[model samples]
Target: MNEEELGTDLKKRIKEVLSGSLHIRHVDTGSCNGCDFEMSTLSNPIYDISRFGVSFVPSPRQADMLMVTGGVTSNLEKALRITYEATPKPKMVLAIGACACGGGVFGETYANAGGIDPFVPVYVYVPGCPPRPQALIQGILLALDQYEEVLKRGE
Candidate 1:
């Protein structure tokens, strides 16, 4: 779907699954910031994800979803785990970009731990060197579907 359609769908999904708001905590494990930059665009006028009831929170404790970018670096592994633990239950974790999805060019190294699956349960993976804002919205929509299913199962 187009970005506009995706945004409309995302708004509906957030209203249904999250009481009309979806607070996200964005974490940058150890990326070069490419993915993070793309994610930031969602807040700009062109994308304006906030208009769809999505907003980025400063703390995981206040977030309904975690939008993680970059490879799981050794230095940030503990921090990532802590953030995931801090987020309330029924939370959705989205792995953004190729690095967070896998290892990207950085790969598994002595300082990087590859993908984040080993640290936290990821509900969606938006793969790209730096996925566009449209892809991020789509990922959130996909996560909302899974989150709704989990809620129905009472998990």
Candidate 2:
């Protein structure tokens, strides 16, 4: 499919996964805050993701999706696990940025504990040192595709 078609398909899948409920909780393990900055901008006037029926939640327990950024750090492992554990069933994790997906610049650093996938299964990975907001959105939409099928099977 063409890029536009693919994007449209992704959006459709996202809508299906959401099914009128798409609350996300963001976690920062040890990011440089660049990803966080773009994520925050997603809610602003320019590209309000709320228009697509998505919202950012403060508590993990109340979220249907976990949007994690940054490389997994030794100090934040416990917190990350707790956050994931707190999230209710049928939740998907989206690792945004190269750091979160592959440890990026900190891959072999003393403080690095690897990527998010090692600790918790990542449904999607947006690969960029600091992924653009559009890239993050696309990753979320891709995860939604698999998430919808999983939910349908009641897994």
Candidate 3:
């Protein structure tokens, strides 16, 4: 095979590595805990996120994806940045609510850093004061699609 063909084959392999499942690491910057509650329900028997190959891990190092909620408050900025850094490469960050996506009601206040995107790259932005569990699931799946595309590009 030619070099060009080999490059295409390599990209295909990278994408295939991400097609299976995503284990998440959830972070709450400075929201009202509304989105956190919704995330907790995802693991319950009703939502059963595990069945979908989505589960929350305790440490960022062990997580496959990062799910962040609430605006990036100044106090939590370092922690958020560090957590994102610790998560492995090719990891996707999902902004779980309006605050995390674009600061919501807080909106770049003295204490808020606007959105998580400013601190770390965000792949999917799930909008809502506190989005429904279903929305979060959809956001994860959507990010998964983008995630594969990103890997294909060798980025």
Candidate 4:
């Protein structure tokens, strides 16, 4: 599909995913807070992801999607896994930023082991060293597509 059509399709799928009960929990593995900053903008009046039927939760256990950012640090691996496990079935993971996707500039460093995919099954990858808010929103919409697929397969 063309870009516009694809975006429309994604928005439809996101609506479907939100038709059911779903909430997102954000995790900052070891980012420089740039990704976090962009994510925070999603809640601002302009973007207002809530109007799109998405909301961020505080606890992982209460979340249906895990929005993770930053390179995965060895110390945070266990916590990340625990958080993923805490999320119930039919969960989705969104790896935002170059750091979360492939460790960005921190890859192979002693501090960071790798990206978030190794720690959890990432459903969507938003690649940017520090992604813009619009890009992050697109990633979120893509994740809702995955979420809809899972629901379709009756998983």
The C-alpha RMSD of each candidate to the native structure, in angstroms, is 1.3, 2.0, 8.0, 2.3
How are the candidates ranked when ordered by TM-score, highest leading?
Answer: 1, 2, 4, 3
Cα deviation in Å at residue 64, candidate 2?
Answer: 0.7
In candidate 3, position 139 carries an lDDT of 75
lDDT of 1 by residue, 1-155 (tens): 45658878888878888888999999999999999889899998988888999899999999999999989989999999999999999899999999998899999889988898989999999998888888888999899899999999998
Q: Candidate 2 — number of clashing residue pairs?
A: 0
Q: Number of clashing residue pairs in every model?
A: 0, 0, 0, 0
lDDT of each: 0.90, 0.83, 0.80, 0.80
Best by TM-score: 1
Measured by lDDT, the strongest candidate is 1
Q: Candidate 1 clashing pairs?
A: none
Candidate 4 residue-wise lDDT, 24-140, digit = tens:
899888889988988898888977767656689999888888989889888888889999999989898999899988878888687897688766888988998788877776776
* Whole-structure CA lDDT of model 4: 0.80
Show the colliding residue pairs in model 2: none
- Best-first order by lDDT: 1, 2, 4, 3
How does each model score on TM-score? 0.96, 0.90, 0.85, 0.87
Better of 2 and 4 by TM-score: 2
